[model samples]
Target: MINTWPKNGRALYTRETVITAIRKTITAVGCVAALTAGAVACGTEQQLSPGKQLSNAFDAMGKQHSLSVEMGLDATPDQLIAMSKGSDEPMPPAMAKAMSKLKVTFSAQSKKALADTEQGDVTGSSMKISGGEGDLVEGRFIGDTVYYRVDLKAFAKMTGSPAPTKEDLDAKLPKGLGFADKILDGEWVKVDTKAMKKAAEKQSKANGGSGVTGGKDGKDGKDGKTPSGKPTLSEQSQKKILEELKGVVNHEVTIKDGGKHDGADHVVATAPFRTVLKSVFDKLRPFADEMSPGGAAKMPKEEDFKEIPDAKVSVDFALKKGKLSAASMDLAPLAEKAKIKGEVPLRMTFDDSADNVTAPANATAIDPEEMIAGAMSLASGARGATGHGGVHGADTSLYTG
Candidate 1:
C-alpha cells in the first residue's frame, strides 16, 4: 500500500510549499477565467488605427476602478466536432459531444484590481465559473480572506459522473471525501489569507528559510534587486510582452465601425488570430523562463503552432454614452480548416460596475493540513483513472490487476 501522508498524519511538505502550490494553482485558474461575454485580441483600420485603439481601450479597461466581465462560447456540438476532425487524433466523440452541449462561461466582478500586486489594493473581487448545467465553481476575495465554493452536483455532471445531491452530505460525507464537505454542499469556504502567509513565514523562520524547496542562497524567488546590466525579471518580462504585443497592437490589428449595437457606438477590432497568438507565446516564453525557477516553464517551438489556421479574428466593442462598456469576439475564421458550417463566436461584455464581493457569514474554515492530505490521496490515484490520450487505445480503467 502506498503511504499517502507522512507518519502520524503529519504533512510531508512545509506550510510555505503547500501555500505556494495553492497560490500557483489559483493563478493558473484565474488566467483561464472567461472574458466579458466574449474575448480575443484584434488588427488596424483608419488614421487613428484600430491597433492603437485596441491598445488604448485595453489600457483604459485595465485602469478601471470597478468592472464586470462575462464570456460565453456560442458554438454547437456539431461545430465543435467538425473543428476537432483535423486533429491528429480527434477528440473522443463522447467528450466532444458533451463539451459542445456544455455552456462554459466565466465572469469576474472586481473593484480596484488594476494592479493585482497587493491583495489589499483589491478592495473586492468575485469570480465564478458557470456552465449549462449550473455553477461549477465560485471564488471571492474580500478584506484579508478568500471565499470559494465548488458545486459538486455541477462538477460531477461536467466530469461525466452522476450528480450528487446535498442530501448525501447532509447525512454523512462519502468515505475519503470529508475534506470536501463545503464543496459538496455548494457552500462558501473561507481562508484567512494573512494567516496563511504568517504560517508560511513561521515555518520558514523556524528552519531559517532553508527548506528542501528553498534556493541554494536561502531564498524562495530571485532577489528584489536587479542583476548587473539588466532590469529585474518582472520588468524585463513586462517589456518583452509589450514589444511582442506591438505586432497586433500597432500593426496587425485594425478597427472598423460596427455601427450601432444595442444603441451604443460599436467598434470592431480585427487581426490575424494565429499570428497574434504566436507572437504572444513567443514573447511570454522568455518571461516564463526567467520567472520559473529551475526553468520549470516551457513553451512550444514555432513548428508546434503549424496546426493553427491563419484566419482573421474580430472583436466588437460597444461604447455607451462615451464610456467603455462591452465587447464580443468573432472566432469563426480561426476554425476554417475544420470546414465548420456554422458560426463560432466567443462573446464578451464589460462595464464599470459595483463589486459587491463580501465575506460569507456561514463560510467553513478549511484546515490546510487536512485539505492537503485529501488532495494527495486523490492525486495519487488519479493517473490510473485518466486516459493519456496520445497513446491510442490506452486503458483508462480506474483499477487493474
Candidate 2:
C-alpha cells in the first residue's frame, strides 16, 4: 500500500500479505458479490449476530482509501527458474523437451490486488519443473512497470533447450493476465452465512432430493427454483448475502452518537467479517462451481502444468474501545503444487487521529491516455539512465548471449 502525504511529508510503500490474500479472495469472487446482493442471513440476536457486525464494518469503510499491494506466488522450483528466463513467444519445443526430463516439484502464487484507489495489480511467481531443479523469478514494481529477472540457464535446463532472452519474458509476461483495474468495484462485503445456509437448504429440498447433491450448476436443472420449492443459488441469492453481511458488520460500530472519526461520521465499528467469513466458507464449500463456475487457467500448450487449487481467506478485525481500529486476514492452506502455503497474512488500519484523514479523496479513476503517458515518462527515464540510447524504454531486461 502506498500513501503519499505532501503535507505530512510522508510516502509509504507497503505490501500487506494478509490483505493481499483477502483481496485475492474478494477479487476471485467479487463478480459474484455484485450479482448476489442482500444474500446474508442476519438474525436479530444482537450480540450473536455476526452478520450485523460485518455490515457495520462495511459501513464504516465508506471512505475509500488509495491502496497498492503486491502478492508473490511461489512456483515450482523448476518452473520458476524456467519462467524467469525470457521468451519472445510460446516456446513449445523448449517446454516439450524440458518436460521430457522434468522431475522438479512445482508451486505457484498469484496475487490480485487493488491499487491507488481504483487501479489493480495482479502478479505471480513460480519455480521451474525440470531435472528436479529450478531458478527463481524475481520482480518488483518500479512505478507502473513491473521489472522482472529470470535465470536463463534455469530456463534452458527446465525446457531442455536454451532459455529465451529477456525480451522474450517481457513480451510474454504482459500478455499473461497483466494488472487490472475496476474489476472489483461497486460494493464489497462478506457473504451472509444464515441466508446462504437457508437458501442452500431450500434449493436442496426443491431439487426433489433428500439432500443437496454437488453439481457444476447450483440446481440440477434450469428451472431456477429447486424441486423442493427452495430458491437456488443465483444472482439474486448473492445480492441478498452481501446486503445482510454489510448490515451485520455495521451494527457493531460504536459511534459516539454525534462525534466523528477520520473526518467522516464518527461511528464505532467492528469487523464481524472474520466470523462471518468462516460462515461463508462453510456455506460456500458446496457452491464453488456456481461462484466462479467457468474459465480454465490459460497456458501455452507445451508448458501445460497441473492446475493449482484456489486459495481460501479468513478475516479478523481488531476493535479498540468499541471502534473498528484494525483488520487482519489469514489465508487458507496452499495446494501441494504451490510452493508457498499456510496462513499468509494481510492488514488494514484506520487512524482517526491522523490529521490528514479527511473526507475520502476522489477515487483514482483511470484515464487511459494519462496512464499511457505516465508509463511512457517512466520508461523514458529508465532507458536514459541505462545509456542504451533508444531501446524504447528501460534496460531492465534480463538477457543471455
- TM-score for all predictions? 0.67, 0.28
Name the regions of candidate 2 deviating beyond 4 angstroms: 1-48, 60-312, 332-336, 339-342, 357-401
In the range 1-401, model 1's lDDT, one tens digit per residue, is: 11113224432222122224234323322322212111234232352443344445666767666767665556676775676677654544444444544333333444455634344566677777665567666788777778898765654454443443444332222254554766666788887776665555455547555433444454453433211222236765676566566543555555666777578877676666566667656656766646554332356678867876667766676776655566655455655767888676665566666556677788888765445444443443434334441112222211111
Candidate 1's displacement at residue 352, Å, is: 1.3
Task: Give the worst 10-residue stretch by lDDT in candidate 1.
Answer: 29-38
* Model 1: residues with Cα > 4 Å off, grouped in runs: 1-63, 88-118, 158-160, 163-177, 193-231, 234-244, 247-251, 284-296, 384-401
332-384: candidate 2 lDDT, tens digit per residue: 23222334434433334544332221112233333343333334443454345
lDDT of 1 at 294: 38
What lDDT does each candidate get?
0.52, 0.34
Clashes of 2: 75
lDDT of 1 at 279: 64
TM-score for candidate 1, please give it.
0.67
lDDT agreement of model 1 with the native:
0.52
Candidate maximizing TM-score: 1
